[model samples]
Target: MKYLLQGFTMGLAYVAPIGLQNLFVINTALVQKRSRAVITAMIVIFFDITLALACFLGVGAIMEKSKILELGILLVGSIIVIYIGYGLIRSKGVMEKTADVNIPLKKVITTACVVTWFNPQAIIDGSMMLGAFRASLLPEEGVNFIIGVMSASATWFLGLTLFLSIFKSKFTDNILTWINRVCGVVIVLYGIKLLYSFIEIVKGY
Candidate 1:
């Protein structure tokens, strides 16, 4: 129970941030049908689970022990994040009439995977935060902790998609455009922060 609570809290806190993952999910919910949005959420959840497990196992150790590898990951992730953000910022305004445009499942899954996996910030968070916590736990406790984290991810994505689906009609096209702009700016700022952090880390070496 204690481990469960700890994992749930930590996982919720980590996932609650308004990052690229959330933004991508939100956009999908807005544009796609409920079924499609749910599919995207599931893919995101899968990545979350996979990453959480990876960190809990031993991948985090590998990352921590290799400064060059960590730096490389950070650099690549930051650049990709910046590029995605730039594209979002420059995208045309969302049109309600086009909201139902049929996007292929392959494209949706691919995009979700890229966004979830390619983001360095997400990798760092899982590895550093969850990894440290997992290291301090008993093996059984670690299992419970991971379960708690997975539950959080599942709950968050499902709830977010449902909420967006329910209130989607209330939001005007202009409102969605503003949302896109705001989310884009936030992502860009986050990318810049990641880059800056990388530079600082490099300076120490």
Candidate 2:
């Protein structure tokens, strides 16, 4: 129970940040239908849990040990995150309506995977955070801890979707555009942080 509560709080703090996953999920909820939004959130949750489990298990430990691997991921991920942010900021045609966007379910699935699975910063951070926690716990508490993490993911994403759906009437096109712009700026800042981490790592070598 101690581990369970700890995991839940840590997971919430980790997932609450406005990173790529949150941006994608929020965008989906804003422009997509309620049903589609729920589906997208669910898909994101699935990939998120998968990544979290991998980090908790051992994948993160591998990265922690491999300086070269960590450096490569940090550099590449920083560049990609910055590029996405730039694109989001400068794009004139924000996805204003579901009718205009109409992203396919298959595409959504692929994107969910990409945003969660292939995200370098997420992988590194999750490993650093969850992996450390895993090491500190009693071996038998692993299940409880991970279950707490999974529950937090479900709660946050689903709650976000529902919140957006209920008040979606208030998000006009202009407001949505500004929200995207702000999110883009935040993402770019996050990328710069990752780049700084990469530099700090290289300095140690």
Candidate 3:
């Protein structure tokens, strides 16, 4: 029970912070159907949970075995995150259009997948850090820990979506631009952390 609380707290600390994914979901809620954003959240949650499970199942051994692979992934993920952050920082428009719109389900799914999968830190965070954390708990506590992480994920996604949906009308190009900038900055920090970790891993190798 204590471990479960710890896991839940750690999960919230890891995920509750605003990032690219959060901004994307918020934007989706403002422009597209709210369900679209919820779907995106579900996709991300599933990916995260899947990776966490892998880490819990000793996938960290593989990650630890190949320092070169870790370095490569870290470097690549850092670069991509930095680029995305730059784009977000310079973004001028993020508001919903006044025009009637129809967003295709395929595009929604594709966008969600690309955004979620392209993030290298997402894999490391889910499959390694959180997963490893889960591994440290007693065997009986493992399931509770997983449930805790999942709960945090669910709480954040649903909370974000619902909050944005309610006040979606308040979003303007300027407001969204600021939100993007903030999220961009946070993401860039994550990127920098990834790069630093990569360098450390490479040095150890």
Q: lDDT of each prediction vs. the true structure?
A: 0.70, 0.73, 0.62
Best by lDDT: 2
Range of the 10 consecutive residues with the lowest summed lDDT in candidate 3: 93-102
Give lDDT tens digits, candidate 3, residues 7-36: 576565556544556666666666766777
Candidate 2's TM-score: 0.64
lDDT of 2 by residue, 70-105 (tens): 577667767765765676576443433433225888
User: Taking the tens digit of each residue's C-alpha lDDT, what string does model 1 give over 127-180?
Assistant: 655554543456788789889989989998998889889998774656645655
Sort all candidates by lDDT, best to worst: 2, 1, 3
Q: Candidate 2's error at 183, in angstroms?
A: 16
Residue 162 lDDT, candidate 2, scale 0-100: 92
Candidate 2, lDDT over the whole model: 0.73
Candidate 1: segments with Cα more than 4 A from true spot: 59-102, 169-205
Model 1 residue pairs with clashes = none
lDDT of candidate 2 at residue 5, scale 0 to 100: 78
